[model samples]
Target chain A: MGVKRFIAVLPQCQALGMRVESADHEHVLFSLPFAECHIGNSRKQLIHGGVIATLLDTACGSVAVCALPRFEMCPTLDLRIDHLRPAVAGKALYCRASIVQVTPRIVFTEGVVYQEKGRPVSRAVANFMRLGAGKTPVEMDEALFSPNNEGEE
Target chain B: MTYSDSMAQLVSETQRSGHWETLLEQIPYAGFIGLTAQTLGDEILFCMEPLESNTGNPLLPALHGGVIAGFMETAATLNLMVSLNVDQVPKVIDFTIDYLRSGKMKPTYATCILSRQGQRIANVQVNAWQKDRETPIATARVNFLMHDK
Candidate 1:
């Protein structure tokens, strides 16, 4: 199936408060809102770092499987993140991730989580290994973004 | 001793326990420097400073899912110290995050509430919010493998 079709059938990113901002040939844009529950300070409010990682993880995963020519599967092997700045509270954070390179065996991408008006909050490089079609559903379910599945919760 | 001293002492306790040190390096530099821990009753209060560069939008900034997962991981690891009733490094077997709302781009807080701490395993729940606990940005249930000394 085409990447667009696959994403359409997949479950909504309800838990992460994920919203699809835009998608193109090589890049994707997403957004998440800031609420009272995420506040950590009164003076210079900000969002938590963990939340940023989750967004990057999901975004990178989406980038990996989108628009492939064959029926190949992919899974995250490891992800590394570096925090750069503080995302001020009450302001939304934007993520701009691009697929830097993709090979037959691995997918590499660089993502940046930054404020709308300021410098980047964090940057990440993620690597995902391609899984063969013979893998079981349980194995595929853990890493691959299955449309009808909510993952191994 | 003063409050800051007490906090310093508490951090030392956490640091000496090797619990904080183990996971501190595991998180991205942004998360490690942003997260803070404190003693709260039988649990630990973990604090986070949201980075503007990490949110979804500039107009109404919010936290991302990956960031929350990292924070949850840290919170769960720290809580293992209390849940296992020991100060040692706990291995996280598996973790799940339930994003409730768009985490505000501000200082968020979470507390590790140990549900069960057995000889070999520990379970904890972490809740995070910006202002009111009612509107949670994310919620998580973590399982850890505890090998205490």
Candidate 2:
């Protein structure tokens, strides 16, 4: 399955309005547009730290899965994030994640979230356990790669 | 009243009335995620009911890892706000989370314990559990920079 389809299968990605800007075996970049619902501090109009964390986690997970030869269920083992600065309000947020290392059982990834090119909002490092084939839900496979489901959403 | 004073008053009133909904109304993201909090004596318990939008994997139908992290962080921040009685929102500096188990599609609960509270920074450890309090699905350590007003 393609990376975009894989991301589309996840419900949280849909809920957050995450879109695939670019993806490949080497790295994946995702974007989330700013919305009023994402505001953590209404008075300051700042996006929530958790929203940034969500973006990092999603990016890291997607990149890890894409690194595999085939799509598999990759469950996060641990994740760490550092917020360098507040994300710019009323702008789209972007996260670029890449695989640091890959083993038979685990995939390590690192990611950074930013609105502008030079200014980073947060950085993340995470690892996911590579649950081999057959671990993923059969229904999910059908929903992801199925010819009938294509162009539906 | 200044912003700090108003925040303090809001917190005290919420505590006295045991109405956490009033406090949550101010946080848009918390409301968006369907996060709820209830005062448990001096402590607070945060909860997120299973919502379809929060699910990651279908079939086993687990909650998204990011959602779990978001819930825990949100809980910690609110817990800090109530504990410190501060006016400004605490800005997260860093967060580390360990996933012990998959967050099943069910009601998840979390509580925060202050690890340390210095003048400028505060460290909070959050534990999230479903089914039982002892077996946590995820545990997180969050450090925040306090901007006291």
Candidate 3:
């Protein structure tokens, strides 16, 4: 999507400092660099858990549309995350994803988030339901996936 | 991706990087990597290594969900170094994650990629794994707001 077009689609995502690291029809990759503001402590950094949840949701939703035409919308049905560790602030992070399985009714995907030097950080699997053409999928926003509380679908 | 020293050096430059370190000290999780700040060509990297005592989640054997989310957020912020072109922390607008499997009883690493960068918004994806990349424990997608420094 063009810069203007992307902005129109996700206006609230602006605070993430995201940059399209790379993309293809079947795959897309994104990045977020760390700095002082993201840190929680000298011994550790404070990164909101919901941020990770959103990354997985978007990756899965996009992967669900891999077989569909561009500009199509796919909404998430189920998203589960297993956080492994506390992220260290002031570092670069890399997130990559692809469509693992897709069906007429649903799309199954697996995605990963990593640190520079190719260290594995977290892995996620999700399912997305394909929406009818010209139909808007369910509105699943960040507030719905905050780690502070056990999210409800 | 290279560390400035073999062992992380606690210095003022580290604190000046951001308040992440400051906040991390308040939490009592053992899986925190405790990384300071990093720099790249238009990008910066975040680092964290799990502590040995972080076994609070008996079910997962490693870090807890709350802690993992925290790490994912940190990785997303690293992408800000590219979008904002500054060393400031990016505010998370919203995000989602899918936990593929429970992490190993060891450390989990994470990194983020910026899929869309704009004048007012950003989109990022994060992947995390332990020991081997072949098997990932969790993945996430995040959106953040870019405002004045």
DockQ scores of all models, one per candidate: 0.13, 0.80, 0.08
lDDT of 1 by residue, A5-88 (tens): 333333223433566577655677778787543443222355655567666776776677653443454545556666565667
In Å, residue B42's CA in model 3 sits off its true spot by 49
For model 2, what is the alpha-carbon lDDT of residue A8? 76
lDDT sort, best first = 2, 1, 3
Candidate 3 similarity to native, TM-score:
0.44
User: Which lDDT tens digits does candidate 1 get at residues B1-149?
Assistant: 75334434544566556455433433343343377766655556788787554443233344545666777767776666444444334555555565566666788888777888787877788898788878877787777676644
| Candidate 2 residue lDDT tens string, B1-149 | 87667777887777677788777877888887789999888889999989898888766778989989999999998899887777777889999999999999999999999999999999999999998999999999999998844
Best by TM-score: 2
The 10-residue segment with the lowest total lDDT in model 3 chain A: A137-146
Give lDDT tens digits, candidate 3, residues A8-83: 2442233444455655556767666664433343333654444455455555555455445534445455565554
Show where candidate 3 strays beyond 4 Å. A1-4, A35-43, A137-153, B1-149
DockQ head-to-head 2 vs 3, winner: 2
Those runs of model 1 whose alpha carbons end farther than 4 Å from true positions after fitting are A1-12, A37-44, A70-72, A133-153, B1-73, B76-149
The lowest-lDDT stretch of 10 consecutive residues in candidate 1 chain A is A1-10
Considering only chain B, what TM-score does candidate 1 achieve?
0.73
